[model samples]
Each structure stands twice: as C-alpha cells, then as structure tokens.
Target: MEIIQTCDEMAMACRVAARPLGLVPTMGALHAGHLSLTTQARCDNAILAVSIFVNPTQFGASEDFSSYPRSMERDLALLEEQGADLVFAPPPEEVYPAGFDTWIEPGAVAEGQEGEVRPGHFRGVATVVAKLFTIVRPDRAYFGQKDGQQVAVIRRMARDLNLGVDVVTMPTVREPDGLALSSRNAYLKPHERQAAPVIYRALCAAEQLWRSGEQDAGALRSAALAVLRSELLVESVDYVRVVDAETMVGVDAIGEQAAMVAVAARVGGVRLIDNVVLV
Candidate 1:
C-alpha cells in the first residue's frame, strides 16, 4: 500500500489512480471493526483508499485528544494485509494548518444526545470528513453503524452540501460477548473492559422490548435505562433514547420506521456508545 501523507500528494495520487474509488476514513489504531470496512471497500471498488488521521479538531477541550490511540506502524501493517491500495495518513499541521479557520455547521441531526454532551464535536467531525471527501474524492465512503448519530450527520452533510460521495455504512463489528470494538477500548481497565458489554446488552434490552410489542418510545427508553442502571460498573448514563435512525430525532412510537435504541454511558470512566436498529 502506498502511504501518502500530504493533501497535495493525496490529490495527485487520486488523479492517476483507477476509477470508482472507495474510501474508508478512520482515526487509526486499526481494530477488527476498521478492517471490516477496509475489506468490504476493497471488494466493492476498483481502488481502495484508507485515511488514518486522528483529527484533533474533533476532540473538545477536556476530551482525550492528546491521548487518543495511535499505532501507525501496526495500522500500516494491517491495512497492507487487508489489501488497501492507498492510505492517507496526514499530520495535524497538514490537515488544519496554521490559519485554518473554516468549519462546517452540522445542523439538527447533531443537536441532541451525543451532540448535547460533546458540543462542537460533530462540527469537527463534519469539517474533517468534508476535507477527506474533497481530498480523496471517492465514489463511495464507508462508516460503521456503531456511530449512528455520526452516520446521520455525515449523510446529511454530504446531501445538503452536494459532496457527491455515496456514504455507505456497514453493520458494527462486535466481540463474541457483544462489546462493540473501539480504539477507546484501550483506555478501559481489565474490569472496565469486562463491564463494557453492558452497553450492548442495554441496547438489546430495548430491542427485546421493541420485539415484544412495546411501541411506546418512553417505555423503550426505560427498558434500556433499566438494564444500564442495573450495572453497578456504569458510572453515568448520558442519554438513552428511541430515535429516528435517519434524522436522529426522537420518536414516539415504532410505527413503520426504523428506530435506533442508542446509549452513551461512562462505564468505569470509559465513555462508550452502542446501538441496535429496531426495524
């Protein structure tokens, strides 16, 4: 795999590379979940480009920006093994630069839940993603459904801004015990790692309620919240809701639409988000 580190080089690489390119954008520390996206992208398009930038703009003042995981040597090895054709692993200054001032104002889709807690988080996310879309110019971009709100925000950004890239999302990869794979999983202690699967179980509790003819959104929220609260390791519950999978807006009933039973909580002080789509 050719590792291009600068924007100009990446643009030039895109210029001569094959058509129908596929992009898998990531903040490196490649796990099974990330490899899953890369593997699928390789099969779907003629050229596969994976970006490994841990965007600093996405992290808030108190967030783990300085300490977010970085394993470039291993990440490159994994990408090469997964058959990735190109990788754009840029430095922070290369992406934001000294005078970088412009930002994307992600609208309603980013107004609640994770948005409420992590203010300006999606703005950083939207802006960096827009930069990637502009630089890579992929025919299709892949994201994991684990980031439900993120996918919704990016989809809206691409459509409203006419970015002209198909934002394809794949099912979230999970462990055999159901904990969603995440780079932040590295921060969890042994006990915290063991307790983290409760997030998925909470989503499943809400799913079970949906499957058992519980249509009231409040009740669904309550069901998931109950399971979450039962876990003593759960330090805090940020938000648990039955929201429209597309718009990230809260829903009153299941009806004919798909809803995301999403949860964000601090388990052993390691914040984790997970969801299950109830159709």
Candidate 2:
C-alpha cells in the first residue's frame, strides 16, 4: 500500500489512479467498524484510498482529542490487509497550516443532536471532510451510519455544494454483545465496558415499541431514556431522540417514512452513542 503524508502527494497519487476511486476517511485507531468501510470501498471501486488523520478541529475544548488513540503502524497494517491502495495520513500542519481561517459552515442539519452538544463539532467535521474530498477527488466516499447525524450532515453538504462525490453510508457495526464499536471504547473501564451495552439495549427497546405500533415519538424517547436511567453506571443521558432519518429533526409520530431512534449517554466517564432505524 502507498502511504501518503502530504496533500500534494495524495492528490498526485489519486490523479494517476484508475477511474471510479473510492475514499474512506478516518481518524487513526482502526476498528472493525472502520475496516467495514474499506471492505465496501474495495468492492465498489477500481482504486481505494483511506485517510487517517485525527482531526483536531472536530474536538471540543474538554473533549478527548489529546487522549484519542493513534496507532499509525497498526492502522496501516489493517488497511493493507483490507486491500486499500493508498493511505493519506497527513499531519495536522499539512491539513490546517499555520493560519487556517476557512471553515465549512454546514447550517441546519448540523444544528441539533450532536451539534447542539458538541458545538462547532460538525464545522470541524465538515471542513476536514470537504478538504479530504477535494484532496482525494474520489468518485465515491464511504462513511458509517454509526454517526447517523454526521452522515446526514455530509450528505447535505455534498448536495448543497455540488461536491460530486457519491456519499455511501454503511450500517453501524457492533460488538458481539451489541455495544457499538468506537475508538473511545478503548477508554472504557472494565465495569463501564460491561454497562456500555445498555445503550444498544435501550435503542432496541425503542425499536420494539415502533414495531409494536407505538407511534408517539415522545413515548419512544421516554422508553429509551427509562432504560438508560435505570442503569446504575450511566452518568447521564444526553439525548434519546426519535428523529426523521433524512432531516435529523425530531418527529411527533412515526409515518410511512423511516425514523431513527438515537441515544447518547455517559457510561462511566466514557460517552457512547448508538441508534437503530425503524421503517
């Protein structure tokens, strides 16, 4: 696999590649969830590339940016095994430069949910992802539905800006016990890890209600929150929202269209997010 560290090098490499290139952008610290994207990229395109930069812009002041896992050697090994052709692991300076003033403001779809909590988080995400999209110039880009709102934001940005890259979203991959796979899962203490699956269980409970003809969005949110509240290790429930899948806006009732039940809570000191979509 070709390992690229600079924007010019990455752009040059991509320019010479075969048609229909696929890009999978990621922060370092590879997990099965991330590898899933690479797997699909390999299947869909003649040339596949992955980026592994832990974008500093995306994290809040008190967020775990400094402590976020970084294992470039291990990440490269995994990508190579996954059949990736290129790895663009650019340094922060190469991405942001000395005075990086421009930012992509992703408006409404980003205003609620994670955005409300993280503040400027999606701006950072949008900026870095737009940069990656430009640098890689792929025919399609892959993202996991694990970050559902993020998928929504990026899709919106692509459409609005005419970025021309097809945004393909794969399903969220989870652990055997149902905990959604995440890089932050590394921070979970043993006991917190044990309790973390509660988020999935709670989302499942809401899905069950939807399947059972429970149309009231408030009821679904309450049912999920009750499950989290009952968990002894759960520090707080950030949100348990039943939102329209496309717009990322909360719904009052389930209609013919799909809706998503998403939950974010602090289990131990680690914050984990998970969701299930109901049609």
- Candidate 2, residues 202-269: lDDT per residue as tens digits? 99888898889899999999889888988999999888888889889889999998999988899999
Model 1 Cα lDDT, one tens digit per residue, 1-279? 899999999999997889899999999999999989999999999999999999988899999989999999999999999999999999999999999999999999999888999999999999999999999899999999999999999999999999999999999999999999999999999998888999998888888888889999999899889899999999999999789999999999998988898899999889999999997
Worst 10 residues of 1 by lDDT: 201-210
RMSD of each: 0.7, 0.7
| Backbone-clash count (model 1) | 0
TM-scores across all candidates? Answer: 0.99, 0.99
In model 2, pairs of residues that clash are none
List the global CA lDDT of all models.
0.94, 0.93
Error of 1 at 187 (Å): 1.2
Clashing pairs in 1: none
Q: Candidate 1: deviation at residue 174, Å? A: 0.5
lDDT at position 82, candidate 2: 91
Tell me the spans in candidate 1 whose CA falls farther than 4 Å from its real position: none
